[model samples]
Target: MPEKFVVVGAGPVGSLAALYAAVRGYHVELYELRPDLRDPATTPLNFTKSINLAISERGVNSLRQTGLTTLVKDVVSSTTPMKGRMLHLRKQGKYVREAQLYDARGKNLLALDRTSLNKTLLDALESMPNVKLFFHHKVVGVDFNKKLAWFERRTPSDPSSRGTEIEISFDFMIGADGAHSAVRYHLMKFTPVAYQQEYIDKLWCQFHVAPSPKDGKYRLPPNYLHIWPQDEAMFIALPNQDQTFTSTLFLTRQGFSDLDAHPDRLVAYFQDKFPAVVPDLIPADELVKQYNENPHLPLITIKCTPYHFSSSGVIVGDAAHAMVPFYGQGMNAGLEDVRVLFDFLDQYPTDRAKALDQYSKVRTPDAHTINDLALRNYREMASDVKSPLYLLRKKIEETLDVYFPGLGFATQYSRVTFSNMPYSEVQRRAAWQARVLNCAVGGLGVGVLGAMWVWGRGGGWARVKRGVLLGCCWIARGVVGVVRGWE
Candidate 1:
C-alpha cells in the first residue's frame, strides 16, 4: 500500500504539496480551516493577507515542476505583467510620475489576485484521484511518534460551534498553515524548535482604484506597480485583470491611530502626500469610504528552525517562515519551499527520514535570509526609492550589468525575482557585488583626483580631460578584471 500523506491547511502551499504527493502515488488528504474558496458564498479568510500579490520566477518555477503542463500557463494568463515600479509624487507643485524598471533585461512580475491563484491550485488538486480535500477542517493536534493527527470540523453556519473531532492516521504530514498555525503549535510539543516572531510597527489597509468611468479602463498605468512613497508612510497599487487596481496604504501603528482619530483629515492627508491619487484616480469621498471600510492589519515576521519533526511531519509556507510582504516574495518563497522539500524527497526516495533531515538543515538559513530581506525592503519601498543616491547606485549597477554580462552582474531585485537561486546565496552574492561596486567607485574617484593634481602641475585643461577619461577607462577595466577573477 502507498503511504498515506496528510497535509494541514489547504492554502496554496498545502494544496501544491498535496498535488506533489498525489503525483508521487501517495494517498493524500488535505485539510483546511476554511471552506472551499471556489464557492462564491464562502467568506474570504484574509487573515491580514493582501488581496493581490506578485508572482515571480520562484513561484512560477515551483508550479512548473509539478508536471502539470497547463497549470503555470493558466495561472499566468489571469495575471497582469508589471515590468517595474511607477512612482507617483509631486514636483514643482505639480504631480509627476517616474518609472523604475525592476530589471535591465526587461523581466517582469505577474500581478495576480490571491484568491484566483489559490483557486487554480485547489482546482488542480481536486482533479487528482489520489488527493482528497477536507475543507472546514482545522488541525487540532498531532502525535508524530504514532503518525496521527486530530482535526475539528468547523460548521459554516456557526463558526464558533465546533463539531466532532476526527482522528486520522498518516505515514507523513505536511503543515502549510498560515502565521498562527495550529500544526506548528502542535509540532513544538514534539521537538525543541527554536521560533521567533515579530510584529512590525507598520499596519496596512487596502483600497480599490476603480476603472475609469469614461473609457472603462485603468485610471493609472496598468503595466507597473504604482507607489507613492511618503517616508514614514507609503501607498502602493497592483493592477488586476479587470482594469482595476488593488491598492494598499502602509503606515506606522501610531500613524494609523492618529488618522483613525481624525477621519476628516484623511483626504487632506492624501491630497498633501499623494496628490495624484486623490480627486483624480480615486475621488476623495470614495477613498475615505474604502479606508473606513477596510481593516488596518499589522505586519508579522516569523522565523523558526527545524521545520520538520523526525520523519512524520514537516511545515512549509508561513508556518515555517512568515515574512513581511514588502519584498513581494512571501508567497513565492512559500511555493518554492514545496519544490525544495519535494526535490529532497525525490533524492532520497528510499529514506524519507534522511530527506526531511537534509531539507530542514538546508532550508532554514535560506528561509531566515528572505525573512530579513523582506523586513529590510520595507525601508526601501517606503523611502529609498526616492533617494538620489539610491537611484544613482541602481543606475550604475544596471549599467554594469548591461555592459558586462560575463561578470555575472545582476541587481539584487533581479536575482530574487527573475531567478530561482537560493535566498541565502542571493544575499551573499549581492553583498559581494556591493563591495566590488564600492571598490570600483573609490578607485575611480582616487584615480581622477590624482590625475587632476598631476595635470594642475603642467598639463593644460584638454590634457586633464583626456587623462581623466583614460583614468576612468583604466579603472573600469581593472574592476572588470577583479570581478572576473572573483567569478
Candidate 2:
C-alpha cells in the first residue's frame, strides 16, 4: 500500500481534499505555492475584491457527508439565506424587483465570504495530525512514475530577497493545483489526458456598498441579495458579516473599454441607471477609480480527463474541472468532488486503484455539463430573462399556478435550483415540458375562438360545455405525452 500521499495547492478545495484523505487514514502532505495565508502579516493575493459565494443543496449535502456539518456551520454562521433569485428590471428610469423562488415553499441557498470559508477549512486541516502543510513551495514538476515533486521554497531573506530550490517525493500524489497545474502537465505524459481550455471575454471588477450604520449592526435588511440589471451590463451585491455589501460589476470587453476611456463617467452611468445604489452606498470617486484601475480578468474554464498519476494518485477541484463563476458552484463543486471521492473509496474498500479510476470517469461528465450550464446562465441572469418573451412565459406559468399549485415550482429555474436533478437532465425535462405546455395552450386558444364564433349565434349551454370538455381533453393528451417521455 502507498504510505505517503502529497496534495498540491492549499486553497479551500485542495485543503478539503487533504483533510478527507487524512481522515481516511492517508498520511498527507499539502504543498501551497503561496506563503501561509493564516499568517496575519503575509500580504494577500490580489485575487478579487472579496467576493461572496452561494451554496445550494448539492454543495451542502456533500459537505455534510464528511460529518463536518458543525465545522462548516461555524464558519458559515453569518451567511444570509437567499430564497431565490431577486431579478432586477429596469424600465424608463426606474428599477423594478421580482422574486423568483427556487422551491415551492421558498427553500433558500446560502451566501457568504469566500475568505472566511477558506480560512475555516485551512484551520481544520492544520488541526489534523496526518496533514502537514508546506507553504511558499512552488511546484515546478511532477514525476508520476517515480512519485516525485519539484519546488522552489520562497522566504524573504532580508526585506528584498527570497529562498531556494526544494524537492519532495511521496508514495502517492493529487493534482489539485488548479487550471495551469504542473502535476496535470506531467501526468498527461503517461495518461492520454484529454484537455480543453476556453477563455471567456467577459471581464469583472468588484466594489463594495456599505450598510447603513446606526449604533453598529447592519442597517439594510441583510436577507436578500441586491442586483442592478441593465441587460448588457449588470451589478450584483451580497451582504457580508461586517454590515458591508460586496458587489461585482460584470461587463463585456467592449463595455469595459468604454468605461476605461471615460473613467469619470461610471458614476454618471450608475446615477442614471442604478441611482438607488450609488452616492450613498459607494461614493462616485471611489467607484470610478476601481472601474478604470482594477485589472479585469477573463473568466476561463479548464477540463481534463483521467485525472490521476498511474494507479497511485488523483486530482480534484479546479485542476480537474475549472468552471466559470457565474453559477456560484465552482468551489462548491470542488468541495463536492472530495465527498464523492471518499464515498467511492469506502465502497471499493479493497480496490483503491479501481476506485480512483472510476471516480475520474463518473465526475468528469457532470463537470462538463455544469461548466456549459454556468456560462449559459450568465445570459439568462444578465439579458434573456429581461426580455418580453421571457416575462410572458413566466406570466403564463404563474397564471397556471393559480389553479395548478405545483406547476410554477416545476419551472426550469426551480428544477435547476430547488430540485436535486442532474443539470443536463433538468434542461432536457424543462424543454420537454415547454413543448407540452405550448401544444396545450395552442389547442385551448383555437378551441376557445371556435366556440366563441359558434356561440355568437346563441348556441345551447350544453354545446358550450361540450366545446370546453373537448378543449380540456386535448390539453390532457398533451400532458400525458410529456409524462410518458420522462418515464
Candidate 3:
C-alpha cells in the first residue's frame, strides 16, 4: 500500500504539497479550516481587496516542478507584466513620474491575481484521483511518533454546532498552515523547535482604482508597478486583469489611528504627498470611504528552526518562515520550500528522516535571510527608493549589467526576482556590490574636496567651484570609459 500523506491547510502551499505527494502515488488528504473558496457561499479570504501578486522566476520555477503545465499556463495567461516601477515623485513643487526598469535585459515580473492563482491550483488538485480535499476540517492536534493527527470537522448544514473530532493516521504529514499555524503549535510538542514571531509597526490597508469611465481603460500605466514613496509611509498599486488596480497604503499603526480620527485628513494627505492620487487614479470620496471601511492589517515576520519532526512530519511555507510582503517573495518562498523539501526526499527516498534533517540544516539560513531581506525592502519601498544614493547604486549595477553582458554582473533585484539562486547568496552579492559602490563614491567625494581645498587656496570660491565640477565630470568620464571598455 502507498503511504498516506496528510497535509494541513488547503491554501496554495498545502494544495501544491498535496498535489506533489499525490503525483508520487501517496494517498493524500488535504485539510483546511475554511470552506472551499470556489464555493458560492464561501467568501474569498481577502474580501477587503483582491491583492495582486508579482510572480517571478522563483515562483514560476516551483510551479514548473509540479508537472502541471496546463495549470501553470492558465495562471500565467491571466497575468499582466510589470516591467518596472513608475515612481511618482515631487520635483520643484510639482509631481513627475519616472520609470525605473527592473532589468535592462527585458526581464519583467508578472502581476497575478492571488485568488485566481489559488483557484487554479485547487482546481488542478480536485481533478487528481489520489488527492482528497477536506474543506472545513481544522487540524486540532498531532502526534508525530504515533503518526496520528486530530481534526475537527464542520458540516455545512450545522453551522453553529460544535464540530466532531476525527483522528486520522498518516505515514507523513506536511504543515503549510500560515503564521498562526496550529500544525506548528502541535508539532512543537514532539520537537524542540526554535520559533520567533514579530509584528512590525507597519499596518497595511487596501484600496482600489477603478478603470477610467471615459474609455473604460486603465487610469495609470498598466505595464509598471506604481509607487508613491513617502518617508513615513508608502502607497503602491499593481495592475489587474480587468484594467483596475489593486492599491495598498502601508503606514505605521499611529498613522492609521490618526487618519482614522480625522477621515477628511486622508484625502488632503494624499493630495499633498501624492498630488496625482486624488481625482486622478482614485476619487476623493472613494479614497476616504475605503480607508474607513477596509481593515488595517498588521504586517508580521516569523522565523523558526527544525522545520521537521524526524520522518513523520514537516512544516513548509509560512509555517516555517512568514515574511512581510514588501519584497513580494512570501508566496514564492513558500512554494520553493515545497520544491526543496521534496528534492531532499527524492534524494534520500528510503531514509526520509535523514532527508528531513538535511532539509532543516540547509533551508533554515536561506529562510531567515529572506525574512530579513523582506524587512529591509519595506524600508526601501517606503523611503530609500527615491533617494539619490539608492538610484545611483542601481544605475551603477544596471550599467555594468547592460555593458558587461557575460561578466556575471547583476542587480540584487534581478538576482532575487529573475533567478533561482539562493536568497543568502543574493544577499551576499548585494552587500559586496554596495561596498564597492561606497568605495567608488567615497573616493570621488574625497577627490572633489581635495581639489576644492587646493584650488581655493589662491583661486577663490568661483575657481574652486569650477574645479570641483570638473572633478565630478572627470569621474563620470572614467565610469563611461569603463562601460565602453566592457563593450
Candidate 4:
C-alpha cells in the first residue's frame, strides 16, 4: 500500500501539494476549514474580487514541474501580462504617467486572479482518484510523534454548528494553512520552533476601477501594473480578464481614520494627490461607495525557524513565512516551498527526517530575506517610485544591461521578479551592485574636483578635462569587465 499523505488548507499551495503526492501514488486527503470555493454562492476571499497575484518564473516553474503542462498553460492564458510599472504622478493640476519596464530583456509578470488560480488547482486535484478533498473539516490538533491528526468537522445540517471530532493517521502531513495556521500553532507544542510575527502600522483597503463604459475596454493601459505613489500612502491597480482593475489603497491606520472622519475630504484628497482617478477611471460616487463598503485589513509579517517536526509533518507557504505583498512574491515564494520540499523528498526518499531537516536549514535564510525585501519594497512602492534619483538609478542599471549583456547586469526588480535566483543571494548581489555604483560616482566626483583645481592653476585645464574624460571611460570599462569576470 502507498503511504498516506494528509494536507491541511486547500488553497493553491495545499492543492498543489496534494496534486504532487497523488501523482506519486500516495493516498492523499486534503482538508479545509471552509466550504468548497467552486460553489457559486461561496466566496473564496472575503472580498468580492481577489487581490491580484503576479505569477512569475518561480511560480510558473513550480507548476510546470507537476507534469501538468496543460493546467499551467490554461492558467497562464487567463492572465494579463504586466510588462512594466506604470507610475501615476500629479503635477500642476494634471496627471503625468511614466512606464518602467520590469526587465530590459522583455520579461513580464502575469496578473492572475487568486480565486481563479485556486479553483484551477482544486479542480485539477478533484479529477485525481487518489486525492480526496474534505471541506469544512478544520484541523484542531496534531500528534507529530504518533503521526496522528484531529479535525473538527462542521455539522452538515448547519455548517455553522460544530460537529464531532475525529482522528486520522498519516505517514506524512503537510501544512499550508496560512499565516494564522492551527497546524503551525500545534506543531510548536511538539517541537521547539522559534517564531516571530509583527503587524505593520499600515492597513490596506480594496477599490475597483470599472472598464470603460462606452466599449467595456480597460480605462488604463492593460499592459502594466498602475501605481500612484503618495508619500504616506499608495494606490495600485492590476488588470483582470474582465477588463476591469482591482485597486488596493494602502495607508496608515491614522490616515484611514482621518478619511473616515471626514468623508468629503476623501474626494478632495484624491483630487489633489491622485488626480484624474476620481472622474476618469472610477467615478466619484463609486469611489466613495468602495471606500465605505470595503474593509481595512492589516498587513502582517511572519518569520520562523525549523518549519518541520521530526519528518512526520512540515509547514509550507504563508504558514512558514507570511510576508507583506509589496514585492508580489508572497504566492510565488509559497509555491516555491512546495517545489523545494519535494526536491528534498526526491533526494532522500528513504530518510525523510534528514530531508526535512535539510529543508529547514536551507530554506529559512531565503524566507527571512524575502520577508525583509517585502518590507523594504513597501517603502519603495509608496514613495521612492516618484524619486528622481531612484528613476536615474533604474535607468543606469537598464543601460548597463543593454550595453554590457555579457556583464549580466540586472536591476533588483529583475532579479526578484524575472528570475529564479535565490532570494538571499539576490540581496547580496544587489548590495554589491550598489557599492559599485557608489564607487563609480565617487570616481567621477574626484575627477571633477581635480579638473577644477587644474583650472585654478591657470595652465593645465585642457589636459585635465581630457584626463577626466579618459579616467571616466576607463572606470566604466573596468567595472563592466569586473562584473563580467565575476559572473
Candidate 5:
C-alpha cells in the first residue's frame, strides 16, 4: 500500500502539495478550516484582504513542475500582465505618471486573484483519484511519533456550534496553513522549534477602482501596477480580469485610527497625498464606503526553524515563514516551497526522514532571506522609488547588466523576481554587485579629479585629455576584471 499523506490547509500551497503527493502515488487527504472557496458563499479567512497577487517566475516554475500544463496555460490566460510599476504623483501642481519597468529584459509579472488561483489548484486536485479534500475541519492536535493528527470538524450549517473530533493516521503531514497555523502551533509541542513572529506597525485596507462607466474599460492603464508612494504610506493597485483594479492602502496603525476617527478627512487626505486616485479613479463616496466596510488588517512576519518533525510532519508556505506582502513574494515563496520540498523527497525516496531533514536545513536560510528582503522592500516601495539616488543606482545597475552580460550583472529586483535562483544566493550576489558598482564609480571619480588637478597645474590640454581617457579605460577594465574574478 502507498504511504498515506495528510495535508493541512487547502490553500494554494497545500493544494499544490497534495497534488504533488497524489501524482507520486500517495493517498492524500487535504483538510481546511474554512468551507471550500469554490462555493461563492464561502467567506475567505480574515488574515488578509483579497489583494490581487503577482505571479512571477518562481510561482510559474512551481506550477510547471506539477506537470499540469493545461492548468498552467489556463492560469496564464486568466491573468493580466504587469510589465512595470506606474507611479502616480503631482509635479508642478499637476498630476503626472511615471513608469518604471521591473526588468531591463522586458519580463513581466502576471496579476492574479488569489481566490481564482486557489480554485484552479483545488479543481486540479479534485480530479485526481487518490486525492480527497475535507473542508470545515480544523487541525486540533498532532502526534509525530504515532504519525497521527486530530481535527475538530465543525457543522457547515452552524459553524458556531460545537462539533466532534476526528483522529487520522497518516504516514506524513504537510502544513501550508497561514500565519496563525494551527498545525504550526501543535508542531511546536513535538520538537524544539525556534519560532519568531512580528506584527509590523502597518495595516492594510482594500479598495476597488471600477472600470470606466463611459467605455467599461479600465480607468487606469491595465498593463502596470499603479503606485502612489508617500513617505510613510502607500496606495497600490493591481489589474484584475474584470477590467477593475484591486487596490490597497497601507498605513501605520495610528494613521488608520486617525482616519477612522475623522472619516470625512479621508477624501482630503487622498487628494493631498494621492491626488490621482480621488474622484477620477474611485468616487469619493464609493472610496469611503469601501474603506468603512473593509477591515484594516495588520501585516505579520514569521520565522521558524526546524520546519519538520522527523519523518512524520513538515511545514511549508506561511506556516514556515510568513512575510510582509511588499515584495509580492508571499504566495510565490510559499508555492516555491512545495517544489523545493518535493525535490528533496524525490532525491531520497527510500528515506523520507532524511529528505525532510535536508530540506529543512537548506530551505530555512532561503525562507529567512526572502522574509528580510520583503520587509526591506516596504521602504523601497513606500519612499525610495521616488529618490533620485535610488533611481540613479538602478539605472547604473541596469546599464551594467546590459553592457556586461558576461559579468553576471543583474539588478536585485530582476534576480529576485525574474529568476528562480536561491533567495540567499540572490541576496549575496546583489550585495556584492552593489559594492562593485560603488567602487567602480569611486574609481572613476578619483580619475576625473586627478585629471582636473593636472589641468589646473598647467599640464597641456592634450596630456590632461589623455589622462582622463586613460583613467576611464582603467576603471572599466578594473570593473570587468573584478566581476569576472567573482564569477
Candidate 6:
C-alpha cells in the first residue's frame, strides 16, 4: 500500500510535490486557498511585473528527472537567448545601451510566465488518478500530533466568508504553502524551530511592455533580459511567450514614498530618466496610475531550522527558506528541493523518519547559502551589470573559458542560474576562482609595466605587449589542449 499524503498549497512547489508523490503511487490530496486557477476567471496574477521567472539548468534537469519535461515544455517557450544583460541608461533625451553576457560561452537563462508554469503543472496533476485537488479551501491549522488538518470553507468568489472550521486526516503531510506557512506555524507548537523573517526595505512595482505595434513582435531584443541601472534604484524586464516583456522597478522605502507623494510627477520622471522605454511601452498616465494603485511590495527573506516535524510532516520550498527573487532561484530551488527530497524518500522507503531528518540536514545549508548569495546578487544586477570594467572582466573570463574548457569555475550568478552544483561547494570554488582572477590581473598588470619600462629604451612596449599576448595564448592553448586531450 502506498503512503497516503496531504500536500498543502497548490502553487508551483506544492503542485510539484504532489505530482511526484502521486506518480510514485502515493494517494495525494492537495489543498489550496485560492480558486481552481484553471478557470480564466481566476484572473491569474493580474497585470503584474512578477510575470515570468527565469528557468535554467537546475529547474529543467529536476523536472526531467521526474519524466515530466515534455509536458511542461509544451506550455512554455524560451526567449531568443540573451548573451548578456542589456543595460538602459538615460543620457540627454535618449537612453544609452550596454550589454553583459551571463555565460562565458554566451548561453543564457529562459523566462516564462509564472502562472503558465503553475497551470501546466496543475493540468498534469489533474490528469493523474492518485492526485486530488481541494481549491478555494484555506488551511487554518495543522495538528501533527493527530495527523489532521483544519480548514475553513471558502468559495472561488469572496473566499473569506469566514466559515466554521473542518478537519481532514492524512498519513503524512507536506507543506509548501510559502513564507507565511500555517504548517510551519503549527509545527512550532510541538517543537521549537528558530525563525527569522526580514522585510528588505527595497520594494518592487511591476509593469509590462506590450508586444510591439509592428506585427506584435518584440521592440527590444526578445532574447535579452533588459535592465535600467540607476544607482540606488533599478528596473528590469524579462520576455514572455506572448511577445511581451514584464518589467519590474525596485526602489527603496523612501523612493516609493516619494512616488506616492508626487504621483503626478511620475511622467516627468519617466520622461527625464527612462525616455527610451517609457514612450515605447506604458503611457505616462497609465504608468503613474499603476504606481499609485499597484503594490509597492517589499521583498521578504525567511530562514528557519528543522524544516520537518519528526514523523508526520515537513516544510519545503519557500516555507523552509523564503528568499527575495533577485537571484531568480526561489522557484528553481524549490523545485530542486522537491526532487532531492523525493530521491531521498525513495532511497530510504521504509525508514521514512530517517528520510525527513536527512532532508532537513542536507537541504538547510544549501537553502541558507543560496539565500545569502541571492541577496548579494542584487548589487551585481542593479549596478555591476552596467559597468564597463565588469563587462571587460566578463569578456576576459569568456575568453579563458573558451580556451580552458570545463577546467573552470562559475560566476556566482552562473553557479546558481546555470548549474546545480552544491551551494556550499559552489561558494567555496567561486571564492578561490576570484582570488585566481585577482592574481592574474595583478600579474598581467606588473608584466605590462615591466615590458613598458623595457620599451622606453626603444621598442620595449611593443615587445612587452607581444610577450603578454603570447604568454596568455600559450597558457590558454596548452592548458586547454592538455585538458581536452585528457578528456
lDDT leader: 5
Q: Per-residue lDDT for 17-119 in model 5, tens only?
A: 9989998999999999888888877776642466678999999999999987797897788899999999998889998999999998899999998888888
Kindly list the per-residue Cα lDDT of model 2 for residues 133-233, writing each as its tens digit: 88878777777777777887777333224568778878778778877777778788878989999988787888867666545555445667666667677
Which tens-of-lDDT digit does each residue in 1-487 have in candidate 6? 7778999988888988998898899999998877876787765543233536887788777777777757656544533355567878865655688666778766678786777778788988999998889887788888898888899877556775886578998888999988889888998887789888899879988887788887888878877888887767887888776787788888889988887788777777766656576677776776877777777787899999888887899999989999998888898899899999998889898887899899888998899998998888888888877677877776766676678656674466677678878787778767766666665666566666667766776765578787577546544543454344322
The digit string of per-residue lDDT tens for model 4 on 187-231 reads 999889999999998999888888899998999999999999997
As a whole number from 0 to 100, the lDDT of residue 341 in candidate 1 is 99
- Clashing residue pairs for model 3: none
**Per-residue error (Å), model 2, residue 356:** 2.6
TM-score of 1: 0.95
Off by over 4 Å in 6: 45-51, 78-83, 90-94, 446-487
For every model shown, what is its TM-score relative to the native structure? 0.95, 0.88, 0.91, 0.95, 0.96, 0.89
Clashes of each: 0, 0, 0, 0, 0, 4
> Can you tell me which runs of candidate 4 are displaced by over 4 Å?
45-50, 461-487
TM-score of 6: 0.89
Assess each prediction's global lDDT (C-alpha) against the native: 0.89, 0.74, 0.86, 0.88, 0.90, 0.78
Question: TM-score-based ranking, best first?
Answer: 5, 4, 1, 3, 6, 2
The number of the candidate with the highest TM-score is 5
Q: Clash pairs of candidate 1? A: none
Q: What C-alpha root-mean-square deviation, in Å, does candidate 1 show against the real structure?
A: 2.3
Which of candidates 1 and 2 is the stronger one according to lDDT? 1
How far residue 425's Cα lies from its native spot in candidate 2, in Å, is 3.4
- When summed lDDT is taken over every stretch of 10 residues in candidate 4, the lowest stretch is 42-51
RMSD of 6: 4.1
Quick one: ranking by lDDT, best first? 5, 1, 4, 3, 6, 2
